[model samples]
Target: MLELTTEQVAALAEIDAKRFVEGVRADLCKDDPKLVDDTTFSSRLWRAFKAAREVGIERDENLVAFLRVEAYAPSFYEQPAIRAWLTRPGRSADQRFHDYLRVVRWHIEHPKFQGGLNNGGSGSAGNRGGSASTWSGLGARWRGFIGRGSGGGSG
Candidate 1:
């Protein structure tokens, strides 16, 4: 259920791929400067994250489908092609691109990020629902639109 906060999405929009990945790593790191380092894994993941963010995937609620690539990606968050793909100006609007933003949205907010793999990679998944300003949050807002608990009742 984890979702992207609007602030997170806005911040991501400004960074280049390298910086975007660094931000994801840092988010996984939970403010621990010691963990940031140069490595292929970090670089590739950054590329994937940057690509996804570009397309509006930065804030989706679905987790498993987002990561599946089912063809959305040629590889995981680490592939040279994905790097090129993300930066290609004409490639920005593809539907698959959103998968990156969506997964990272779930990734950083994972309870593990509250601790642990903020040490290595992101931590194990947890079931915390979406934050305000995202798809899952949008659903919640919709319920309110229909008055979920207000007894105003929805059609």
Candidate 2:
């Protein structure tokens, strides 16, 4: 269990869980262009779990159960790993654990997960075509971290 700051927990609490995971998946897919196909629902859920853990989630088993019940998979049949992860319920536990770790690391390394920081002036806050009400916290999290102290963070 990660000991999250009050602000961090607030940030996590503020997230629209579905959008947060989707955004994380989208960000991860930005590079290869084919990365969207390369990613998986399990990876995204693992990401949500870990990100929430940073804000102090204690039970991933519950999270996994939640994912099994609530996860909405976009049609990603092109990516074998992703497709395999989503459609099959009986995959080796080891694979799921590895994917979970990958998701956690991906979240940590992701720019949006950097705590509301910016990206070389590539975009302006509340100015893009995307929904500001949706990703503003994710957009600014990295900026907040960079603009404030080294340990800076927010949604």
Candidate 3:
């Protein structure tokens, strides 16, 4: 008799695909260590994102509004493409949501970033074609997110 916690329920209700996939991966990794392999996790994430696409569209207003408001803060956190995509005129919310999904699906299917130390690339720690610093930031953020027990209830 498994049940979703308040945070897990909110993540689903809000269509937080990243959170959902990470949570699922953590849970699966607990049961079977091999289940958290990059390939398996990527596949599971793709499936989860695809299955939840419709829900993402249905609940687009939350993300759309958040991105829109963030755009006004004069900060780098506001992605220009997202702002333009969500705020473009003469388009319905659903249409915008679909367009957003199209971009998301494309990224998920064919990530632009493929060469990394973890991916078995031959780049050294200091020579990643200007991506080393980016990976540093990503590493910290990933460690924090995964270490926070986001896999559901108290763990």
Error of 2 at 8 (Å): 22
lDDT by residue (tens digit), candidate 3, 39-77: 645454444344334233345343432222222121212
Q: Model 2 over residues 108-153: C-alpha lDDT tens digits?
A: 3464543345445423334334433223333233233324323533
Off by over 4 Å in 3: 1-77, 112-155
Per-residue lDDT of 17-125 in model 1, one digit per residue for the tens? 4564554555533433323452444644554554565444544322223322311222343345445544556544344456444444554445355334447745544
TM-score of each: 0.25, 0.23, 0.27
Worst 10 residues of 1 by lDDT: 62-71
lDDT of all the models against the reference? 0.43, 0.42, 0.42
- Say which prediction, candidate 1 or candidate 3, comes out ahead on TM-score: 3
Candidate 1 displacement at residue 150 in angstroms: 50
Candidate 3 clashes between residue pairs 3 or more apart in a chain or in different chains:
none
Better of 1 and 2 by TM-score: 1
